[model samples]
Target: MDAVEIKGPAAAFGPRHEDINEDANRFGDRYSIRFVGKDKVCTNLKYKDKHSSVSKDVSKEWCDGCPERDGCAYFEPFNQIKNKTRSLTAPHNYLEIFPDILDQWGDIEVVLIDETPWYNIFEKTARIGAHDISHTRSALRKLDDEDKADSDVIKRALSLLDTLSAGLSDKDGGERQADRAYELATSIDFDELTTELTKIHDGRVLEGTDYTDAIVAIADNLTEIKQTARWASDQGIIGEFDSPPEQLWGVDNSTKDNAKFELRWRNVDLMEIARQKPVFVLATEMPTESVEAMFDLPVVTVEDTVTPEAEIIQLNSRMAGITRLRKRNQTFDNLVEFTRSLFGSRLLVR
Candidate 1:
C-alpha cells in the first residue's frame, strides 16, 4: 500500500499462498492491486457451472474468442504492462516457472522481493524410471506402426529410449559411470526427441484417452532429463566434491523389476538471474565470499546490527552445559522445573 501510494507502481513477491492471500486482503482493495492466482488465470473453471462440461481445448477456444482476452490477466499481464500505475502481486515461483514473465511485465521502478529467491532458483533432481521408459516405448512402437509418414522419427525416439533404459539397467556391466551417462544423454539429439514427443503429446490429447495426462507428464520428464543432462555435463562440476563418480547420474535399484535413474547437479551458477537486474539480498550474516561464490560478479556488502526495542532476560543453567547422554533424566527434570518456575501456576504454554 505504501509503495503504490508513495511511488508510482511497485510489485511484491512472496513464497507462499498464505502470504499472497494476506497481502491481497490487506492492500488489494485499497490500492487497486491485483493478486494473480491459479483460479483467476486458468480457464478450466470458466464454464464448470454449466450442465455440459467443455473440454480443455474448447475452453481455450472460448477464452480466445472472448472480447477481453487481450487485457485479461487470465491470458497475460496485459494491463499491468500497459498501465504504469497498475501493480500486481504473485508468488516467487512464477519467475522460475515462466522465465520471460519479468520481461512481459514491462519496466517497474521498484520490485520488492520479500524472502530469499535463492532457494527457488536451485533446480531439483529429475528422475526417470524403467516403467516410464518401457511404457512410453511401447506406446511409441504402436504409434510407429499406425503412422507411416512419421514412422522413422518415432522409431528413432524408441531407439533412444531403449538405449537409455539398457544403459541404466545393465546389471552385469556394474554401475554406469557419470561420463557414460553424459554419453547416453548426448548420443541422441534433444530437438529430434522433443519433436517426436510433441507429436505423441498432440495425438494423445486429440485421442482424449486416459493416458493423455501421462503422455504430457512423460514429455515434461524427458525435457527435464535433457535439461539436467545438458546442465550437469556442461557445468563440469564432476570431481569437484569428495564423491565425483556418482554425482551426475545415480541409479536406484531398490525395486528389483524397476530401475530409477536420477540426474543431479551439485553446483550451479546464478549468472542468468544476476545479469537480469540488480538484486539486493537480505542475508543477515552470510559471508561476502559465499555470496560471490554462487554469483560470479562483483558484489558489495553492507553490515549492520539490529537492536530490539523490548528488553530481554536470560536464564542460565549449569545442567544445560552437560551432554544429553550424560544425564538424560536429569535434563528433562531440570527443564520441567525451569518452565514451572518461569511462569508459576499461570497456565503457561510453551
Candidate 2:
C-alpha cells in the first residue's frame, strides 16, 4: 500500500491582492505618517502621567462604542503608550481638515495613506469609508423606532452621534472626532459581525461596540452554505462532510489569490479608494511594516509636526511623474502638530 499525505485543517488563506488601483503619485515625494491614531499601543496606558483621555466629567454621554467615551466626552479615544499621547484613529478626525485642504489647493489631487485597515472597515460598514461626514451621519436616519425609541441603549448612542455631528456640521468642531467615530461605529451591522473579524478590528475592544461579524459570516461561507442548502433540497444524500467549509471565516486571509467570502461593504470601499488615488497622502496612523516589503514605492519619512505632508505630483505632458520617499527614522513632536501637518500650512479655510 502507498502512504498518503494530508493537508492541515482549513483556515483563512493569505496573499490577498491589496490596492488593485493604480498609483497616482510618482516616485520621490511619498511620505509616511507614524503613530497617527489614539490606541493602547500608541498611548502608554500603563503610565498615568501622560494620559490625554483625562476629563472630569466622568460620564458616558458619548457612545460607548466610541474610543473617546472612556472617561469623558472628548472625541477620539486617547491612547497612552510609554508616555506618549495618541490621537484618534478616527478618519473623520483626519478628514476634518479637508475643508482647509480644499481652501488651500482648490481641487488639487491628493492621496491619504490610510495606515490601518480599520479605517477602511469602518467606511465600508456604512458607505462612510474615510469617514465621509454626510454618509455616516445619514446612517442614523435609517434607524426605525425600534432602534431609536424602543432601545434605550441605541437612543443614547444616537443622541451622542447627533450632538457630535451638529458640532462638526459647520466648522471642524472639537466634537467632530467623537461624532465621526460614532458614525463609523454605527456603520456596521454589529449584530451580524463575526468574532473572527471583530477580534482583529481595533474598535471591537471598545465597550458596547456594534457587531457586523455575523452578517458576512454566512455570506463568506456561501459555498458551504449552498452545499448544505443544496443537500437539504436534494433530500440529504451527502453527509460526507463533517464541518462547515473554510470559506465561512472571513478573517486573516492576507495572501494574494486568497478567495473567501467577504463583507460587501469592505469590497465596496476597497474598490472606491483604488479608483481615486491621490498624489499626496496624509495618514492618521502608521501603516503596517509589511507595506514597504510588499509595495513598489518606498515609504519616505519626514521630520515634521501637525499634519502629514507629501509633495504634490505635477501632471506634465513632457516630464515623467516623479515620486520621493523618506525613511522611518523621523518623528513629529506632538499629536496636534502631526495631525495639523496633514492639512499643511496654506491659505483660506473656506
Which candidate wins on TM-score? 1
User: Which runs of model 1 end up more than 4 angstroms from their true locations?
Assistant: 1-8, 16-19, 22-41, 44-73, 96-107, 117-119, 123-135, 146-181, 206-238, 241-277, 284-297, 303-350
lDDT of 2 by residue, 10-63 (tens): 101111122211221111112111222223323323322212221212123123
Q: TM per model? A: 0.52, 0.21
Candidate 2's C-alpha lDDT? 0.29
- lDDT (Cα, tens digit) per residue for candidate 1, span 34-64: 4454234544443322211223454566566
Cα lDDT, model 1, residue 7:
47
As for model 1, its CA RMSD to the true structure in angstroms is: 13.7
lDDT of each: 0.47, 0.29
Give lDDT: candidate 2, residue 189.
40
